[model samples]
Target: MSSESSQLHIFFLPMLAHGHMLPMLDMANLVASRGVMATIVTTPLNVPLVSRTTSTPTSTKINILTIKFPAAEVGLPEECEILDSDNSKDTMPLFIKAVGMLQEQLEQLLSAYNPDCLVADTFFTWATDSAAKFNIPRLVFHSTGFFCLCASTCVGLYEPHRKVSSDSEPFVIPSLPGEIKLTRMLLPDLPKTDAEAAYIAKIVKTVNETEERSYGVVVKSFYELEKDYADYYRKVFGRKAWHIGPLSLCNRNSIEEKLQRGKASSIAENYCLEWLDSKKPASVVYVCFGSLTKFSDSQLREIAWGLEVSGQQFIWVVKKHENNAGEKEEWLPDGFEKRIEGRGLIIRGWAPQVLILDHEAVGGFVTHCGWNSTLEGVSAGVSLVTWPVAYEQIYTEKLVTDVLQIGVSVGVKKCDGLLGGSIKREAIEKAVNMIMVAGEAEEMRSRAKTFAKMAKEAVKEGGSSYSDLSALIQELSVRRLHH
Candidate 1:
């Protein structure tokens, strides 16, 4: 490639959530490491968070450009920050509209910079038209797993069959290319009310249209992890799709360096690491729901009691919210935290998730099955106690327990027709005891370790994911030069 072609300037726009922002940031870093110029486009409020994240990084190749949201009157937050709102009903519509308004600003930014191409989240389908107007090649970045993507597509294609009156009956999803079977219980709740359903339908249509126009889709996953689905997308979409993931593994060395520096703020990490250091290898269970998922007080109490009864060392990261107020002891079972005072640690806010999972003492994870958490757990060789909350997490739980067999689902009563059934304290305690004390625990640990090794190898030079990333860079660079 010519020098100019080799040094491409790429712009990335990710969704507002932490899960989306972090992966896109990682991808930008990887591209920058290859001598490409990476520019991140985010809302003004989110600018501070994004800026802070990039500040510690020594690399100066990546740049962040903040854009103002045009329609502030439409209930969107004035600042470019993520709203702490839990009500999806109040947020999703406004977020979709805001993305539309942001397109005008994005168009102007593109005209000024004239970057080679634009890489954006799947949600920002409006960028397709804007990219075309600016004569820039666009690549849609799917933050979720390929399996969930397949499931969502199935919901879109088979719209008629998916519209069940209640969340009770299980419906089989068609056109799944993998050996896995997807039932309605595992699918995401596609906006049940008419207004919500309409909004979802529009989003689905936009995704399909955007995919048709883009150069390709870039997924943060590897071929070995979703071979059949990857192949299926290639055949059906007739567009180039590449798997370059566990992006965490790509920058493991840098992350380790960050940890070694001990520069991470206590506010951001919430001191979960100090607690893990006190536990034995393969002894502590790490529990964390991802950024979006939240729980009711009843559910929270059950989990606390379950942990207490399990009689194992555990570390739980609970985000402080409006609902969870009373004293910590009041929420937990009697003498729970006191009984395991030396063994249990409860963090009230953002925990150093990646670092905590990487710890040798963390034998098992109690997760909501978010893809990022799933990848981190598997990469760390930690077994899972799946407790999916919402969205595509149920599907992810299936992927972990049924497809991979690296983890077990806790309190999921499939035969009872309960979709992601609620777990009582006893159920939680029993599951943990089985996973930690039974002879099966050691076997699960060995399997988790093996999976973690595979994740590491996939990102190493000459590995499947590493080579796929190289090919993607080469292809995009070529497209940039020609366009």
Candidate 2:
């Protein structure tokens, strides 16, 4: 075949949120590096963020395409292009509505370009029909682990939680590999308010419809990371899927790339690196919930005291709301920063998480168990203190604390909403100690290192993820010829 005809062209559509967008872009670049023609489609405002994170001098350049977001039409502010989970409780429906409005623009692009494959975020349920119209294969991109994917799928199918009498009552997920159990309160469907309930219903319908129609799923995971679930997702469910990840591994080559990842760092990378440099290897804990989570004032103070009481050096990235960036937080314990001055650093907005986690001085992570953070901590080989707060995060906590055994839980018992349910200083402190200072800490660290090494190996030439990606490209290439 001619080189022109043989080159596989793939379009990646990520949700407007950073957690979803960043990793899909990472996968786009990884595919582009393997000689596929990769294009990332998003709205105008998000182009700069995407370009900055993926601005690599690679052999194959990834094309960034834009479509207008109907912010004004959806009653969102003119500047509202991306979804911020912290402030999005009331605006989320509007945001999703605005995103769905891009269907016409996406259809236009699909008709004009007719890319060989569409690797779209799972949030874009409509993309399945769009791709079907063009007879192009659409792969659902999930920025989550196979464990959560399988669990969520099984829960949705079996409605195991329906059997439980109370929200706190536990039930086993049926037809799975092992005895995995969770309380009804921890399930994703437990919506607090009518608005949230409606939102959850919409999301569930969107996911179910899209998954049934799409060609297959393209998950951001590596086979070795969650082998049983990966196998279970395909063998038990009888669907096509590919696991080409620890997608974070693509950023391992450059420090500049790591720093510029996602949004600009709130603090200077050099400043944070210098602080970590002074600390001994595996001596510090890096605490960050993913970008979307918001903590109540009470919870923030509890975290502060917990970190102080744990007596471990830490760098915490506190999520700052867009409107209140300059406001003084009344939540921090009085003189908390002063007391932990040398031993702790609190970044009020975006922190260079990848850069910090990759540091030798960093050992344990205090994570909310967002898949991206979970995978990053794994890639960095850092043990974790899991405190899951939102959708599927609690399920991922099970993967980390139970399956992987590289994490300690802070005993979060429910899928709390965006403003997470508070855990006392004692629970946080105890969990931190279990992962960073207790006798079992060494064992967790050892396991983290083992997975970290596997993560790196999975992305290398001939590794599990590398081979999966190659197979995907090959399959798409062959299919393109017929089309």
Candidate 3:
């Protein structure tokens, strides 16, 4: 390792959301551990969140730098956040606007540190331009898997998604190497209002421009998981994209432990982890819907009864905000908690998701199929019962369930807005039974376990992900010398 090839300093600017921020932070830790100087650019409000997951990086060459969030100025509450599940729909525009205001401070820091490369989130579409001003290489760290990336790109380019008559009308995307069929509903949301339409247009334009200016793209994925899509990203897109992931593997236990300690899970508080200890290995279902996915009261009751009917030992995490308008009692089925007292543990607020997923007692997951959760489950060797709640989650579910054949689809087709329609007990019980029960679901479990091994190996010294990460660092270092 020559000094010139390994001495690169990389600056990372992750988007404000937990899904985006946490993975990027894990990436920063990975980059730092790989012998590069990695600095994370964030707002003050989130600094504590990051700090808890990590120590003041002495062994790992990582640093967290913060800027003030203009919450009050932007008519947001003093505690405005990007990833907080409780955030209202109306605050999205304001959150974006507030984060955009950081560009000036970002520019100042870039000048001060003079890093070799600027690795930024996709949301900060202006970051590429800022890196250009400093004559630095801009590498976009997209917090998405390669499968989702390819699917989204193909759908956008082909526009076949628009030809569908309704949300359920599945159509094959006109021109893609892989077979991906999606409906209009699964496609990215089209603008409903004039202002929204304008914002959407501007975002599209900025993202396209950013892509053109980027030196390369870095993703939170591993080569083994989606080899075809990774190949397509490089050969078809004509871009340098590295898949260095199962990102949670970077000190997974430490981060998960810190997060678990930060908040006491509701009612059954510290009981979820302890309860898992009492169950048999690969015997419990860990049910969580990521940070988002607000289920309606009817949907909540359905899940309760479904879990009861499945007769599987489980740990179900329900967020506090899910109880609104003093309707907590009305949400669950009568005596749902009392009936499953010993069999099921209901955690109200945040739980250490990665921790629970990794537990020996956890055999299956009931998930919304968010990229992070998907990877966590994959890494943990846990079979999934997919119930995609929002965003490009349906696309993720397809990748996990259909393409990889490692999970069972619960067939939740329509997206759930805030308090949307119910996912009936039948759907829940069917999927859960498929994953938890024997005979028919063994293949799914075996495939998941196989992929989980690959996920762990991918981050080891000689793995594909390791090689890609090393190449990225070396490339940045060489560019530093030229600069």
Q: Highest lDDT among the candidates is held by which one?
A: 2
Query: How high is the lDDT of residue 147 in model 2?
Result: 95
On the 0 to 100 scale, the lDDT of residue 33 in model 2 is: 82
What overall lDDT, based on C-alpha atoms, would model 2 receive against the true structure?
0.87
Give the per-residue lDDT digits (tens) of candidate 3, residues 1-483.
Answer: 236345778898988887787788778777877778778888877777666554433337468898788888889998785656688456777988888888898999999988888989988888988999999889888867878877777776766856777777989865555677767665546556999978876777778679877888998899999998888878887877988998887756453342432233344424556777888989999998877566766788888999999998888888646556656567678778999989998877787787788878999999888898899999999999988766677788889877998888887656665443467898888889899886757888899999999999999999989999988887776777777
lDDT of 2 by residue, 1-483 (tens): 236456788998999998998899899888888878889998889999989877865425789888999999979998898877555667887998888888899999999998999988887888999999999999999878889988988888798987989988889888876788888888754767999978877778878778877889888888888999999989988778988988888987878878767988889888999999999999999999988888888899999999999999999989865546676778888889899999999997888888899999999999999999999999999999998888889889889987899998898877677777779999999998888889999999999999999999999999999998889888887887787
TM-score of 1: 0.89
User: What's the lDDT for residue 194 in model 3?
Assistant: 93
lDDT of 1 by residue, 1-483 (tens): 236545788899988777788778778877777777889998776776666555545544569898876546577556534533253435766866766677788899999999888999888888888888888888899877777777667667866345666555655566675445544444556455999888778767878988888878888887777677778778875767888888766445655433422123344443456666767898999888866655656677888888877888898877545345564544556666678788788876566677788888989999878788898888889889888766667777877776678777785533221123467888788778766777788888888888788788888889988899888888877876576
lDDT of each: 0.73, 0.87, 0.79
Separate clash counts for every candidate: 4, 0, 0
**Candidate 1 global lDDT:** 0.73
Model 3: pairs clashing at backbone N, Cα or C within 3 Å: none
In order of appearance, the predictions have TM-scores of 0.89, 0.96, 0.92
> Mind sharing the TM-score for model 3?
0.92
Off by over 4 Å in 2: 1-6, 191-206, 322-328
What's the ranking of the predictions by lDDT, best on top?
2, 3, 1
